[model samples]
Target chain A: MRLQDQLLFNLRSLSRQRFRTLMQLIAMAIGVFSVVLLTGLGEGGRQFVMAEFSVLGKDILIILPGRKETSGGMPPLTGGTRDITLQDAQALSRLRNVDGIAPLVVGKAEVNFSGRSKESLIIGANPEFFIMRHLRIQQGQGLLQIEIDQARPVCVIGPELKKELFAAQPALGKWLKMAGSRCRIVGILANSGTGLGFDMNNALIIPVASSMQLFDTQGLFRVMIDVHSLAGMNKLSKEVERVMQERHEGELDVTVITPASLLSAFDDILAVLTVAISAIGGISLFVAGVLIMNMTLISVSQRTAEIGLLKALGASSRQVRILFVSEALILCLAGAVLGILSAEVLLWLARQQFSDLLFIAPWWASALALIVALTCGLVFAWLPARRAANLPPVEALR
Target chain B: MIQVNQVNKTFQLGDQPVHALNNIQLKISPGEYLSIMGPSGSGKSTLLNMLGLLDIPDDGEYWLQGCDGLALDTVPMDEEVRARYRRDHIGFVFQSYHLIPRLTAAENIELPLVLAGIPPDERKERLQPIIQRLGLEQRAGHLPNQLSGGQRQRVAIGRATIMRPKLLLADEPTGNLDSHSGAEVIELLEELNNDGITLIIVTHDMDLGDRAKRKIRMVDGEIVLDKSREQEPS
Candidate 1:
C-alpha cells in the first residue's frame, strides 16, 4: 500500500479501540515522563551548585590547615601539619597575582549589645575580606585600614546579627561587648541569603588582630586568597605553600583549594549522578517497552483478518509489518510529546514554588527521551509486526 | 490463459496427513466463468488458494500467461515473485465479506490500488467507474458493519475489480447472504466475466454452481466432474 494509506489505516485501527490506545499512550508517557523529570532534577542540582559556587567567588582559593584527599565533604586532618595563621596570610598578600587575602578565625561568642545578649558566630578577617567575598555594607562603612592595622575594637555585623542584637534600632556606631572585649559596630552587612552551608548574614566580621586576642588562639581557622586570573591561581597557590613551608620549617601540611578544581570535581560527580538517574529512567522505559510489545501482540492477533485483507490487496509482508510498526510509532510519538509537555509544566510549577532551585529540562533531554521512546516502540513492535506479516492469507482469511 | 497439471497439496492434522488437493488438473482461458462446487473439505478452496498463489502445492506443474517453462515445474515459486504475480494478476472475494471493518466502502474499494501505490487522485479516478458499476456510490462512505450483505458484497466486488486483474476468485461469495443478495452478487460476477475477465467461484450451492458457464464438482480432494455449457450467440 501507499505509505500514507498504510499509516492512515494503522491509525484508524488504533482509534477503533480507544481504551487500548489510551492505555498504551499512558504507559509510554509515564516512561518518558520519569526520564525527563529525573534528568531535569539532575540538571537542576548541577546548576544550583554551580550558581552557589559562583556566588562564593570563582577566582578565590581557600587554604585550610589539614590536607583533604577527597574533594568533597569535610576535609580530613593529616599528620604533621603547620598551623594556618595571620602571619601566613600576610606573606601570601605580597604575591603579585594575589589581589586580596583574608585570615578567617571562626568562633561562637556571646554578644551583649544595648543590654541585649545573643550568641552568634564571629568571622575574623582583614580589610580586604569584604571586597574579596562580595559582602556589601548596607549601613556605615566597612572596617578602616588603620583600624585593621592597629587592632582597633571595631566590627561589621551581619543583617541577622543586627536584627538579633539591635532589633531595628540603629546598630552602626553602637558598642557591643563580645568575648569579654567591647567593640564598636562599624557596619551592618546587606542580607545575602545562606547557600553552600555558609550563612553569611548570621555572623559578625571583625579585624583579624582583635579576633585573635578575643578567641585566645594563634592558629587561624582558614585563609582565603583572591587571585587575579585563572592562569595566576596555580602559581600564586604554590608560592603561598612555599612561603608557609619556609615559615613552618619545611612542613607541607596545608591544602590549597582552588574554586575551579572544586567546581570541576562537583561537575564530575553531578554528571555521573545525571547518567545514573537516566539509567534508572531507562529501566522504566524498558518495562514500558515490554508493555507495548504485549499490546502489539494482542493487536496483531485481533487484526488477523484485516492483515489478510491487506495482503490479498497485494500488500507485501514488509508492508504489512510496517503498517503494524507505524501504529506503535505513532502511539509512542504521541506519548513522548505529551510527556515532554507535562515535564515542562511540572518544571514551571516547581520554579514557581522554589524560585531559587534552577530546574530545567534541557532540549537534549527531550530529544533523547523522544529518540529512546521511538526506538523502544519500534524495537518492541518488531515481533508482533512480524507475527502479523507472517499470517498466511489463507489461514488468516479463514 | 491458465494451466494446471498434477497439482498436489497435503496438510498435517495432528500427525495425520490429509491430501487437500490430489493430483488436480485444470485449464482455463481468459474470460472463462467457472464454478467449483463441493462440500466441506472437498479441496475446492485449496485449489482456488493455489491458483491465487496464496499457497504452494507439495508437487505441481502450474503455469499462467507470460510465465516461463520453469513456471510449470514442481519446484517451489519464490514468495516475493508469487506475491508480485498475485498482485499483478489476481483478486479475491470471501464469504465473510472480509472487509476491513474500520474502512469505508470507498476506502475498501480503493485498497488494491492503494497497495499498488497508485496516487490518491489516480486511485479515485480508477475507482469511480467500478464504484458506479457496483451501485455502491450511495453507500461508499459507509463502513462494512453499516452496510447490508448485498451492499457489502458490492463493495467487495468493487475492491476485487478496481485493480483490473485478469482473474477473479470468490470463495462462497453468498454463503452468508440472503437469496436476493446472493443472486445479485452472482449477477455481478457474471457481468465481470462478460467483460473478458476470468471468474472462479467456489460454492456448495448447486443452484449457484449451475449458473456458471463452466462447472467442476469435487469430492474428497478429487475432481469428480468437469463440464461446460455451449455458448449462446450474443
Candidate 2:
C-alpha cells in the first residue's frame, strides 16, 4: 500500500474513539512535559549558582582564620588563636604576581546621625576591596589606600544607611557617630542587591585600622586575594600557604579556598542533581510507555473483527503490524510536540518570576526526550501489534 | 478458473475435534454462479472461507488462475504471496455486511483499490463506476450505520469488486436484509455473475440456493449433492 493512504487509514482507526485518543495523548504528553520541565529547572538552578559565583569573583581566593579540614570533626579553632591578621594579609601581598588583597574584619556597630540610629554590619577593608568585589562607587569616592596603622577616620556608608541618616539630604562628607566614635562619610556606596551574605547596600565600610581600634581587636575575619592571571595560580596559592605557615610558626592554621575547588564543588553537586532529575523523568516516560502498551492492547481486542476484515481485504500480516506500530509512533510524536511546547510556556512563566535565573530546557533534553519517547512507543507497541497480526482471521470475524 | 482437491479442515472445539471441512473437492469455471446450502456448523461457510483464503486447509491443493498467467496454489503458498494473491484475485461479502463502520461507503469501496496501491486519482476514477453500479451514489458518503441493509451490502459488493477480483464469495449476504432488499442483493449478485465474474454464495435459505445456476448441499463437513441447471450454457 502507498505510505500516505496507510497512514490515513491508521489515523482513521485511532480517531474512531476520540475520547480514548485524547486521553492517550494526555498521558503521553504529561510524561514528556515532566521530563523537559524538571531538567530545565535543574539545569537552570546550576546556571544561576554559577552566575552568582562568577559575580562574587572569578580569579580569587578566600582565606579563613581556622583550618576546616574535611577529615577532622573539629579543630582547635576558637579562643585567641593568631587569627588571619592584617600583617599576614600584607605578607601575602608582597608575593610576586599577587595584585589585590582585601582583609575583612566583621563586627556590628550602631551609628547615630540626627538622632536616627540603626545597627548594621561593619566591614573593614582597603581600596582593593572595591576592585575585587566589582563594586563601583556611585557617589563621591571610596576608601583611600592608606597604611594599615594610620587608622583613617573616613568611612564609606551604603545608600540605605545614608537614606536612614541623611534622608534625601547630601550625606557625603558628613560626620556620623559610630560606636561612640566620630567618623566622616567620605562616599555613598551604590545599592548592589546580591544576597551572597554580603549585602553592601546596608553595610558600614571603614578602613581596616579604624575598625580594629573601634572593636579593640587585632584578629581578622578573612582575607580575599584577587590575582590577574589564571596561569601560575597553583604556584601562587602554594606560596601563600607557605607564607602563612611560616608566619604562624610552621602551623597551617588557615584554610585557603581556591576558586577552582569552590566552583568545582558546586559544579559536581549541580551535575548530580541534573542526572537525578533526568533519571526520574526517564521513569515517567517508562510509565507513559506502559500506558501506551495497555491502550494498544485494549484497542487490539476491541478491533479484532475490524482487523480480521482488513486481513480479508488483503492486508498482509506485516501490513497490519506496521499499521498498529505506526499508530503508536504518531501518538508519541504528537505527545512530544505538545510536551515541548508546554514546557516552553512553563519555562517562560518561571522566567517572569525569577528573572535572574535562566529557565531553559537544553537541546539535548528535548532531543533525548523525543528519541526516548519514540523508542518507548515502538518497544511497547510491538507485542500488541504482533498479537493483532497473529489473531485467527476466521475466529476474529465470528 | 478454480480447482480444489481433497481439501480438509478440523477445529478443536473444547475436547472434541470437529471436522469443519471433510475431503471437499470442487471445480468452478469462470463466470459461473454457484450456491452451497447447509445448517449451522455444517462447514458451508468454512468452505467459503477456505476458498477466500481466509482459512488454510489441513491438506489440500487449490489452484487459482492469475493476472500473470500463473495458476497459484493456495495451500502451500507463503504468507506474503498468499496475501498478495488474495489482494489481486479474490473478494468476500459477509452476512453482516462487514462495512468497516468507521469508513463511508465510498471509502469502503475504495479500500481494496487502496490496499492494492492504486494511486489516488486512479482509485477515484475506478471507484466511481462501482459506486454508480451498486446504486450507492446517493448515499456513498454515509457511514455503514446510516446506510440501510441493502445499501450496506451493495457497498460491500462494491468493495469486493473495486479491485476487479476474478472470484467473489458471499456468505449469507441476504441474512440481515428484508425480502425487498434481499431480492435486490440476490439480483445484483446474479447480474455480476452474468457480467463474467465467478460467484459463489453460501446460505441457509433454500429459496436463495435455487436461484444459482449450480448448487451444492453440505451435511456435516461433506458435500452430498451437486446440481446444475439443465438449460444453462456453461
DockQ top scorer: 2
Share of native interface contacts present in candidate 2: 0.70
Q: In candidate 2, how many clashes are counted?
A: 0
Docking class of 2: medium
Q: How close is every model to the real structure, measured as TM-score?
A: 0.91, 0.94
- Give lDDT tens digits, candidate 2, residues B1-234: 889999999999999999999999999888899999988989999999999888899998988888776777879887677778788888899999887888999999999888778899999899898888988879989999998889999999999888888899999999999999999999999898888899999998989999888999999999998889975575
- What's the C-alpha lDDT at position A394 in model 1? 78
* Model no. 2, DockQ: 0.69
lDDT (Cα, 0-100) at A327 in candidate 2: 94
**C-alpha lDDT (0 to 100) for residue B66 of candidate 2:** 89
Worst 10 residues of 1 chain A by lDDT: A73-82
* C-alpha DockQ of every model: 0.61, 0.69
